[model samples]
Target: ALNKRDRIDPLEKQDSWKDFIYNPRTGEFLGRTAGSWASFSLTHPEYFLRLWVGLGLVASHCQNYNAGRTFCQSRMVSQNTGSLKRYIQASFCLSSSSGYNDSIQERNDLCMVGEYTTQDNEPIKKVCQFKRSTLRQCSGLPDPSFGFKEGKPCIIIKLNRVIGLKPEGDPYINCTAKRATSLQMQYFPSEGRLDKMFFPYYGKKSHPDYVQPLVAVKLLFTKEDYNIEQTVECKVEGSNLRNDDERDKFLGRVTFRVKVSE
Candidate 1:
């Protein structure tokens, strides 16, 4: 047989085989031989400690991935909910009719005492009347007693801004004479009472040609002994109003202080 040293493979001692344990180009450490491990621990103990600490940190972070994922999902949900609420609130609002401010609440003044005459220059002594049912269809007849006409005393209520999403039906106006029940107030749309087709207002910027809906209020003094100075509350009811304290707070009202002078 050959000698033991001569039987050893010469390839095992080559540089390529020695470099296989640690690749400098790829910065990867393959499994070291027993002798190589022992040599590295003794000569570069700090590097070995750093590698062990890095492995421990990586293992701990991997375990927290589920917790981090849950937190991210919850934060995203909260952000989405907040955005939706803001969008809903901004989509609808009630505004003043005078173009003075964008608010539902307002105050107006009217002259109760006037020599309201007809086109024939005839003074109106009795209360002028226009039935709510017939106002839309009835064109202004020559008879001032029947329809809305020029020289007739009337209160003009114009809704300058109405912001809302697409509503189901057209919004109508419901007016009540508060405190001054003797005062007769009628809804006088140039056509009739406010029609439902006017609403679900897109924004002013979106509909530049949008015209504000106007409601003409014709006030008539039914009683001769009415107070000289009276404050009348007229409420214009809106749709889907919130009820609070047994009252619909979303409804807008205008207080008209009328002063009658002979």
Candidate 2:
């Protein structure tokens, strides 16, 4: 889009950007693309929405999987899918690429776990916000595991600062991230299954039929490494754990508390 706006520029051109909106036109170096402003200009609202959504799905996966490299490379989006089959498979743990990880997401002698709701009589709300923290002091950074289920969620509070905190009831799954490649198949994990997983995505809800409009955080994969950037894409259509309502929120996107890997 804006980050790489020339996808449909007047003159045929291409750029390297995964985040931004771009204008569309007829006939480009890539090919004729359905422009958001051109094709959906007069179509029904749903039609326009559908077009944008389809493209969005492709973009998110492209950026996340290839470190923001897809259409820009192949220039041929034969189809849009989430299956690990259609794309280049990742065979190694993302940690192998640690040459790029330096942010809070990659902790030093830290456990890759999230906080659970600190309250007993409540499920974490979509609006509760707080500071960063560590759940336990493990001797070394153990491989992480994660899960999302219908349970109490944890609040993000600054380390040792129970200032506005009063209770601890949320249930959280400790986690570590892996490259989308390692997750060859969707294996349901328990309390701490993804400890060594390459791409660990655990929320309070793991069921594919779950609907989360506003949860706590969104966890996403980045190419630069060690970065936890705030994103607006929350859900993807036909996502394993997504419904139509939650599509526009975190499509191809997940939220988590990264300690600023860099």
Candidate 3:
């Protein structure tokens, strides 16, 4: 009797992309993808669906069905953003991207702030307009002499608060709105940043060495590209690193992404 079992279950028919009244017993459609049921198909699917669960989006099922993932590749595996925010606030350690024991040790082997040792620190936050004039006004930066004649004033950026060993602005940097999702923000260490790396005065055999604080941070967001390059003041409020010998330096500036409304 069971030998007569259909090669394709009724659920498999969901791949047809045709609507039908759902039946729980005869066949089963995945509740996750409301539009279709689950089943093996005659041919490979050229297109698929993705769902946004707030934290991340699902692209498709992994090819290996029995790979034994929670939803069989139906989930968006990612680093927790909350943790990222915390790490932003936590302790940090840095080193010269260049190695220490090189022949030009004095030239390239300066000790710098190491990796961000902790992400548990209090986070900084900010919101800035994407428009040119508005973002310039927000950070009290001088208005640009040329570029987009009129700024996209309606644009905005929402971000976690940040900190700085030294602060150029009290809060967040500005952004550009009404543009593509790609956005970039550039900064000089004198004012704001994520982590400022200080080069140890390697050549300074004497006590009064010139070791200026330098910060380097790179941020890419998957949201709004509101303001492209206007500077905004990122607000920083947090305690210093636990060790007095080392400073958990955060440059008080960031490139931002728009937080879209649901």
Instruction: Report the number of the highest-TM-score candidate.
Output: 1
The 0-to-1 C-alpha lDDT of every candidate, in the order given, reads 0.33, 0.24, 0.24
lDDT, candidate 3, 56-167, per-residue tens: 1111111111211222133211122222111110011111212211232344222334322222331421111122121232211231111111221111222221222222
Q: Model 3 misses residue 185 by how many Å?
A: 2.6
Task: For candidate 2, write residues 1-262 as lDDT tens digits.
Answer: 4567534664333342211233243333234245644544334222222111111121112223442333334322221123332332122122232222335334323323343323233343222221112121110022111111111111111111111221123222222344443211121122312122111212334322111111122123233432332212222222122224454533233233221122
- List where candidate 3 sits over 4 angstroms from the true fold: 1-105, 112-183, 186-206, 216-231, 235-238, 241-262
Candidate 1 stretches greater than 4 Å from native: 1-152, 165-170, 190-192, 222-227, 242-251
Cα lDDT of model 1 by residue, 1-262, tens digit: 8799777577866655666766676544575656776677556332221000000000211232221112223211001111111111001111111222212112211212222211223232222222223233221122212211211223444443444422223344444445544555565564224444444344445544344444555556433523344454444443432112234322344344443222
lDDT of 1: 0.33
Q: How many clashes in each candidate?
A: 1, 52, 35
lDDT of 1 at 199: 44
The positional error of residue 62 in candidate 1, measured at the CA in angstroms, is 78
TM-score of model 2 vs. true structure: 0.18
Question: In model 3, how large is the Cα lDDT of residue 40?
Answer: 26
Error of 3 at 24 (Å): 92
lDDT of 3: 0.24
Give candidate 2's error at residue 150 in angstroms. 34
